[model samples]
Target: MNQNIFENISDLITSGAFLEAEQAAVDLLEEIESKDDGSQAFVIFKFNVAGFLVDIGHALSNRGYALKAVEIFESLEPRIEGVIDPHQYFYNRANAKCHIVEQVSTFDLTFSSIETLVEAKNEYWKSIKEARKVNEEFPEQYVNLANCLKRQFRLSEALWYYDSIREMAPEIPQSWINRSEALLMLNTVSNSYSGKMLHEISSGYNQASRSKFLPPDYAAYYGEQAERFRQGISENDHAETKKEFEELSEYRKYCCRSSLTLSEHGLYCSCAGAARDNLTIPLAATTVGGAFVPQMEAVLNRLKSEFSMARRCYFEYTEAEIEIDLIHEECFTDLETNECLGLDFEKLRTAFRLCFGVLDKIGFAICEHHSLKPKSGMVYFQNFWQLDRDNRREKFEEIKTPGLLALYSIATDLNEHKNGEWKNFKRLRNAMEHGFLVIVHPGSVDDIFGAYELSGDVELVELDVFEKMVEQMIQLTRSAIFSFVFHFRQKGLEESVPTGPTVSFQRVNLQM
Candidate 1:
C-alpha cells in the first residue's frame, strides 16, 4: 500500500466513481494538513487540490451540499487565493459565490434575498480599486461607481462625476439620460431653495439640454422638479433632506459592516439548525468547514456543467491586458456578435474624444444618424495609474481633478465644428469604459448599436455572463493588437505578423 495518500488519491481521482475519489482525497488532505509534511511546493499543490475540490463539488450537482462548498471556498480564498495570482483566483471565488446566490434565488432558500444591490456595490469597490492602481478600468469603473452612488442616494456627487464623462465622451447618449436624472433630482432639490439658487446651478446644464431631442414628457418632468425645488427652500423646511440623509446612512452602515451581512450572505448556515429540520439534505458527504448544506453539492454540480467557464474568463483577460485600441476587434460576448472596445487615457482622452465630437452632432440630429449620446446622469469612469500613491500624493490627485475637468471643458469647446455629423469611436469609448453605449440614434434607428448592444429586450444582471462577454472581447482585442503592435501601431493596417481582428468597427457620419 502506498503510504503517500496524496499520490494514491491523485491516481484514484478519475471521472469514474467520484464519491470514492472524493473520500480518498479528503482523507489525504486531513493527513497532510496534520504534520509539516510538505515543502512550499506541496502547500501550493494543496491549494490546487482545494480549488479542484471546489470543481468537484460542482460536478456532484447536489443542492444539499451547496453550503458546504461555499464554506470550503470562503476559507480557502483567504489562504489560497493569495498563494498564486490572487486577482485571477479571487475573481473566480467571487463568481462562485455569485453562482450560489443565483442558484439560491431560483429556490425558496432559508435566507430571504432582498433586492438590495449589495453584490453590485462590492463589485463597484473592487473595480474602483483596480482602476486606482492601473487606470485600465476608467470608463467602466466610473460608470459603475456613478450607478452605485445613485443607488445609495448620493445624488449631488454622482451628478458631478457623470457631468465630467459627458464632457470627456460627449457622443455617448447614455450620459445624457444619466445627466437628466441627476438634473431632475437637483431640479426637485432646487424647489427648497430661492429662485436665485435654481438659476445659478441650472445655468449651463439647462441650456445644453433644451435641443428638442428629449421627449416632451421627460422635458416636462425636469421642469416640474425644478419648479418644485424653488418652492420648498424659500419656506426653509428641510424635512425631505433630513429624512433622506437618515435612510441613506442606514444603508451605508449595513453595507460597510461584513458581520451584519455574512450570515445571511453565506449559503444558509447549517449552525442555524437547517439540517435537523430536514430543510436541507446531504447530497454528498463533502467536508465543508465542519458542516454540510445540500446546496453546496448543487452549486458544485452547476459549476462543473459550466466548468470551462473559469478557463474561458482567464483566457479572455489574458488577451485584453495587451492594449487600449483594437477593443472593437474582440468578441462581443461568448455568444453575441456585437464588437466592444477598450480605451486607455491617451486614446480615450485624445483620439476617442475626437470621434465623439462628430457623434455628438449626429446624436443631436436624431433623424440623420445612429447615436447614443450618453445621458448626463449615467456615469463616467477613468482609472489612475498607481494605488500605492501616499495620502499626500493622493491629495495632489484631488487637486488634479479640477485640472482634468478643465481639460475636458477645452475638448468640448474644440468640438464646435458644424459639419456633417460624423460618428467616430466616441460611442466605443463609453462602451469600453461604461459597459453601455449609444447603439443607434434612439430617435433615428429602431435598434441601438454599440460595442455591445444592450437592446431593451435583453437583461444582463449576472456578472458572470456580462464579465465573460466583456473579458472575451477584451482578450480577443488585446491579442490582436499585441501581435500587430509588436513592431508597429496603426489604426487600419497591420502587415508583418498575421492574425484576424478580434472585432470590427465601422465609422459612419450623418449631416447635422
Candidate 2:
C-alpha cells in the first residue's frame, strides 16, 4: 500500500469528510492486518498506519469530536504496541479528553464523563513520566495536568504544578494565567478577602499578558479583572494585609495545623461542646432520639483513636535512639562485616503500618456517614469514592457532599501513578503485609555485590527513603482525617433548615 493513502485519510478527516474517512480507515486497517509479507516494508506500513490513526484522532479532537477522538486514539494501542513510542500517543489522547471537559461537559454527576476527565488526568501524568525518561521537559503536559487538578477542585495540588512550570519555563503564558485563576478560586472559596492575595492574582494576569500570542481582547478582559482586584485594597501596610489573608484562609489553617491533631476542624470531637467551635452535632444526653449521635461519635472517635495511635508511634520513632544488639546487627548485616544495611526498627514499622491502616478506617467512616454505599463487602481507601474498584470515576456522579470531592482527592493520592512516590508507599505497605520488606542504608550496600539477589519476594528501600515514606504516610492519613471531618461541616452548611421538629442539645461532660 502506498503511504499517500494514509495521507489521504488524514486529509479526509481534516476536511470533515467523516463518512469517506471512516471507509478509508476501515479498508486500510483490513488491508494492513491481512498482509503477512516477510519484509521490513510491512513493519514500516504498520508504523504509518499507527501514525495515521493518531492524526485522525487529533483531527477529530480539533474539530470538537473529543469522545470520538478518544476511541480513535485507543484503537492505535494494540496495532503498534511494541513498535512505536507511545508518549506522544498518550499525550494526544489526554488532550482530547481534556477538550471534552472544556468544550463538552463533565456531565456534572454523570460517571462516564467524569471517567473521561480523570483518565485524561492520569494519561497526562503518564506522558509526563515518559517524557522525563527521554529527558524531555514537556512543560505543556504539566500545565495540562494542573488544569485537570483545577477542574477537579484541587487548587493546592494544581498550584504546585503551575508554579513549577513558571520556574522551568517562564515564557509560557498559560502557567501564569492558570496559576492566577487557581489562586483567585482559593481566595474566593476560603473567603480570605486579603488585598495582598488579590494583588498577586492581578499581577499574574498582567504577566501572562506579555505573551505575543495572547489575544488583545483576552488580555484586555484579564487586565480589567486585575485592576478590579487591585482596586479592592490600598497600596499600604503590605505586611498586615498579607497577615490578615493568611489568618482568614481556612485552607492554610488546616494545612499548617495538620500535624497538631487530626481533628483540627473538630468534626471528630467526642463531645458536642468540643465540636461547637468548628461543627455542631446533637448530643445524646440532652436531645430526644439522639442514640444515633453516640453511634456516630463512636465511629468518629474510633478514627481519631486510630490516627492518634499512629501519631504516637511516629513520635516515639522520631525521639528514640536505635539500640542495636548483636543479634539485631547480625540479622541486618549484608555480609560478615560490621556495616548494617537493614533497619528492623519495630516502632517505625508500626507507624508505617498504622498510617496506611487508618486510611481504610477513614474510608469506611466517610462512606457510612456520607451515604456512599459500597457495592462490595470489602472497602479500601483507594476504592472509597468509586462504585467499582477498578474505575475511579464510577461514583463521581454520586458524590453530593461538597467536601467529599476533597476527600476523593486524598484517595487519588493513594492511587498508583507513573513515576509517583505514593505507589512506592503502597508497595512497601503491601510488602510488610504479605511479603518481606527491608529498609536498607544505600551506602552500606556494595555495588560489586549487585543491587540485590534476583528474588521477587522481597522489597528493598533505602533507609532515608523509607523514613521519608513513613513521614508522608502519617501526613497523608492526617489529611484524610481532616477531609473526613470537613465533609460534615460542608454538608451542614449546604443543607437547608429542617422541616420537622428538631431538638436542641447542650454540652455535658461526665466526671470520671
Candidate 3:
C-alpha cells in the first residue's frame, strides 16, 4: 500500500475537501484490493485501510452528506467483519444514520431518512451487545441510543435509557439535556407521568444549564427551558389532568391499563382519537377528493377492526380459560425427560396470521393512497417501502407523515433485523404463506431456528415462543394501525385548505 496516497486522503479530509477525499479513498481501496499479494504485511495493511475508510465516512458525515457517508460505510461492510472492531464499526454507522435523521425535514417522509434512523437504532443495539460481550461500559452509546428512542417517539424506553446513563455517568451533560427534552415532549402528549416528573425534569435542565462542557448557546437554551418548566410547576393543573384521564374512552382506558401501556408501546390513544374525530365527516365530490375520503375512511375502519380482532385473539390465547381435554396429553410428560407437546390454540394462530395480514393490507392501502405502482403488481409489507432499490427515493417518500414513517420502520424491523422477536415472527409468517408450519413443545428444541430449518417440509416452533410471537405481533399491529391513521391525519392538517369553490356533501351516519 502507498503511504503517500493515505496521507493525501487524510490531508484532503482535514482541509474539508470531503468530495476529493472520498474519491481518493475509493481509488486507494480499489488499488489495495487489486494488488492482494497474500502476504502478512499486506493483511495488516487491509486493517489500516479499514480504519482510513471509517475516517472518510466521518468526514463526509461532518460535511452534511450523511447518505453518502452511509453508502461508504455500507461498501466497507462486506470486508469489515474481522478487519475492525465490530462494535466500533456499528457505532460509527449508527452515528452516520443519526446525522441523516437530523437532516430529514420534519415533513416529507423519505425512505433513507426514517429508515436510516431505524437502522441506526439497530446498529446501536448491535454495538451494545458487542460491548456487553467484553464487559465494557460506554455512556455515549447509551446516550445516543436514548436519543434514537426519543426520536422514534418511544418516550418510556428513552427515559429508561437516560436514567440508566445518569446512574452510571451523572457527569454527562447531554444525557440530562436529552432527558429534559423527552420530558417536555411527553408533557405535550400525556400528563400521566409528566406532572409527577415536572420538578425533576426542571432540575435536570437546570443542572444541564450549569455544565461547562456545553456551548454557551446550549447552556442558555437549557437555562431558558429550565425556567419555563419551573414556571409550569406553579400553574400545574393536576385536577384538570385527572379529569382528562377520567374522560378517556373505554379504548383509551384499555390502552392505558395494559402491562405495556400507551407510552411503553409508542402507541398513543390521542393520535387515534385525532384521526377518528376529525375524519368522520363525508367530503364533497371532486376529481380525487371524493374517492380519497371514502378510501381513507375504509382503510382506517379496517385498521381498527383488524387491530381489535388481533388484540382480542391475543388476549384470549393468553388469558382465556380452556378445558383440560383441550390440552394435548403429551403436555404431561415426565419432568426429567420432558419435551412436551404443542398446545393447539386456534386463537393464538389466528392472532399471529391476522397481525401479518393486516400489515400487508396497510401496505396496499399506502400504495393506493399514494398512487404508487409496485413492481410486478405485488406489494408485501416487507417490500412496500421501496420497489426498486436503485431508485431509493420513490414518490411514496414525499409523504412525510411521522406515523407512516414509523410504520415503515416496523417493516424494516420485521424484514431486516435478525432480532429474535421480529425474525421469528417473519419466519413463521413465511412458513404459513409458502411452507408448512408446525408447533413443537416449548422444550423440544434446544435452540430456536428459522422456518427454513425444517424437518421434512414443516417448520417447527416452540409453543411458548409462538405464543410470545403472537403477543408481540399483536402489539406491533396496533402500533402500525395508529401510525397509519394518525400520521396521515397530521399530514391532512398540515396542508393548506382549498380556496376555490367546492361542492358540499351531507354528513352521512352509518347505522351499526
Candidate 4:
C-alpha cells in the first residue's frame, strides 16, 4: 500500500500494461501479507492493497486476458467484498466473468464452456441486482446485463431490459439498437401477428396473468383474439403494420402463456415485467484501435475497406434479385416456367440486365485486385484463362499461385458445365448488349434460345438454363473474394485479416 507503488501500478494499468500491473499488484499483496505487526495502520494499507488487486484484475479482463483476470478476481473476492464498495466489487467481478464468456465463445465451444457461460450469466445478474440496490438509475449496469442476456440467447429477457432503458431514456440509441435486434430475432420466428399483440408480447408480460394453465383448445381461442388485433393494427402504414403483425405472431408462438400448457408454465415466464429490471445513463463514446498492434491495425483497416466495398456490391446484387422476384411474382403463374406467354418481355429483360450487371461488378472487383485489365466485356472465362497463363509463365512455372488457381478453376468449371448454362449466360449478355431483343424461355432451343430482332434471330441464349448459372455465379463471386483475401494475406503484404465469426448469407427464395 505504499503511495508510490500504488500510483505506479495504476499507471501500468492505464497504459495497457496489464501483465506488469498484475505482477506489481501480486507483489504488493504478498508484502502486505508478510507484514510482521498486524497494526491498525497496516490494516488500512491492506484495504488499499486489495483495491489495487481488483483494479489490476479489471484491467486484465479489459485486455482479453479473461482467464487470468477471473483468477485474480476470484482470489480477492472474499477480502474485497465488504471492504470496498460492494457495487464496484460486484461490477468488476461481473465484467471479469463476462470477458471469460466472450473469450470462450471465440473458440469451438465444448461442454466445459457451458458451465463457464452459465457462471458468467449468473454473475451478470448478481451485479445488476447489486447495482439496483445501491442506485436504481445506474444505466451502464443495465446495458451490461442486457448484453449478457443477448449473448445467452435469452432474447425475450434481453428485450425487456432494452425496452426498460428506452422507456426511461428514449434518446439513447444503444437501447433502441438492442431492442430492434431483439425484435428482428423474434420476427424471424414469426411474421403474421398484429401490432397491439406485438406490443403486449414484447413487453415481456403475460396478458392473461391469472390463466397459467391454458386449455388444449387455447390456440383456436387465441387465434380469434390475434385476428382481431391484426385488423386493429392494419390501420397503420403498410410497412409498420407488417412489422407489428410479424412480431406479434412470433410472440404468440414463443412467448404468450395462453399458447402453453400447465407443464410449460414458467418456461417463457422469465421475461415477465414483474421479473424485469433496468437502468439508464449516457452512452460511452470510445473506439478500440489503439489496443491492436500497429501492423495488425493497418492490415485490418485495409481489409475492412476492401471487404466493405465487396459487401456493398453483394448487397446491390441481392436487391436486384429481390426486384426480379417481385416482378416474376406479379407477371407469371409458375415461377419455374421456361416460357410465360404474354409476360412483359421488357420487365424480364430488365431483370436479366440487373443479374448480368452483378456479374460484371464481381468480375471487375477480382481483376482490379489482381492488377489485370480486360479491354472489353466481363472477365468471366476468356480473361481468367489469359491471366492464369500469364501468371504461370511470368511468376512461377511449376507451382500456380493458389488464389489465381482458385479463380481460374471456378471460372473454368462454371464455363464447362454439362447443362451449358454458363455459355448461355455469356451469349445472352453479349446479345443484349448488341441491340438484340431478349426473350424469356423455359427450355433450351437448339442448345440455346435465340434473341430476336425485327427481321431475324440475332443471338441464341436460354433463360431457364441461365437461372442455375446465376446461382453458381453468386457463389463463385463469394469464393473469389475469399481467394483474394487469402492471397493478400499469404503474400505478407498485410498480416492475416483478423479472424471473426464466419459470415453466413441467407439463401434468397425467388419462388413465391
lDDT values, one for every candidate: 0.34, 0.58, 0.61, 0.44
Clashing residue pairs, candidate 2?
A: none
Q: Residue-wise lDDT of candidate 1 within 405-450, one digit each (tens)?
A: 2222122212223110111123344553555432221132232334
lDDT (tens digit, per residue) of candidate 4 on 1-512: 45898789877765557688888877886787788374545644655555555555554444344555566556555665445566655665665666655433211333234335445545554565566567654665676667655554344445556656756655443454455444444333223233433543433222221132332244244445434333444344335534433554332333232211111111122222111111001001212122123333343344334433433343344333445655656754443324434434443444454444444444555455445544453465424434334443343223233443444433433353322224455566566677563345755444232223243535544555344444434434434443333333333322245333222223221110
For all predicted structures, in order, the TM-scores are 0.25, 0.61, 0.59, 0.30
lDDT of 4 at 89: 57
Write model 3 residue lDDT over 4-67, tens digit each, in one string: 8777876776555767887776677677778777564554455455545555655454434455
Clashing pairs in 4: 191-246, 193-245, 338-441, 338-442, 339-442, 449-461, 450-460
Query: Candidate 1 lDDT (Cα, whole model)?
Result: 0.34
**Model 4, global lDDT:** 0.44
- Give the per-residue lDDT digits (tens) of candidate 2, residues 1-512: 78789788867754556567767876786797788574545655655554455445444554344555566566556654555456676777777777665443211324444545567776786787677678775788888778776666555456656766777888777788887877665543333344455666777787776665455656677777777777766576355434543553443333232332432212111222122232223322334332334454556677667766666666656654556673465554355322323343566788889877778877776667555656675777875555455444545445544245655655666676422326667777888898877666555555355444546767777766677778767756665555555455444334456433444545433110
Candidates ranked by lDDT, best first?
3, 2, 4, 1
* Candidate 3 ranges with C-alpha deviation above 4 Å: 1-89, 100-105, 112-118, 128-143, 149-220, 230-254, 257-291, 312-350, 387-394, 416-424, 438-455, 461-475, 494-512
Name the runs in model 2 displaced over 4 angstroms.
Answer: 1-63, 78-85, 102-110, 187-189, 234-355, 371-377, 385-399, 409-425, 441-457, 462-486, 498-512
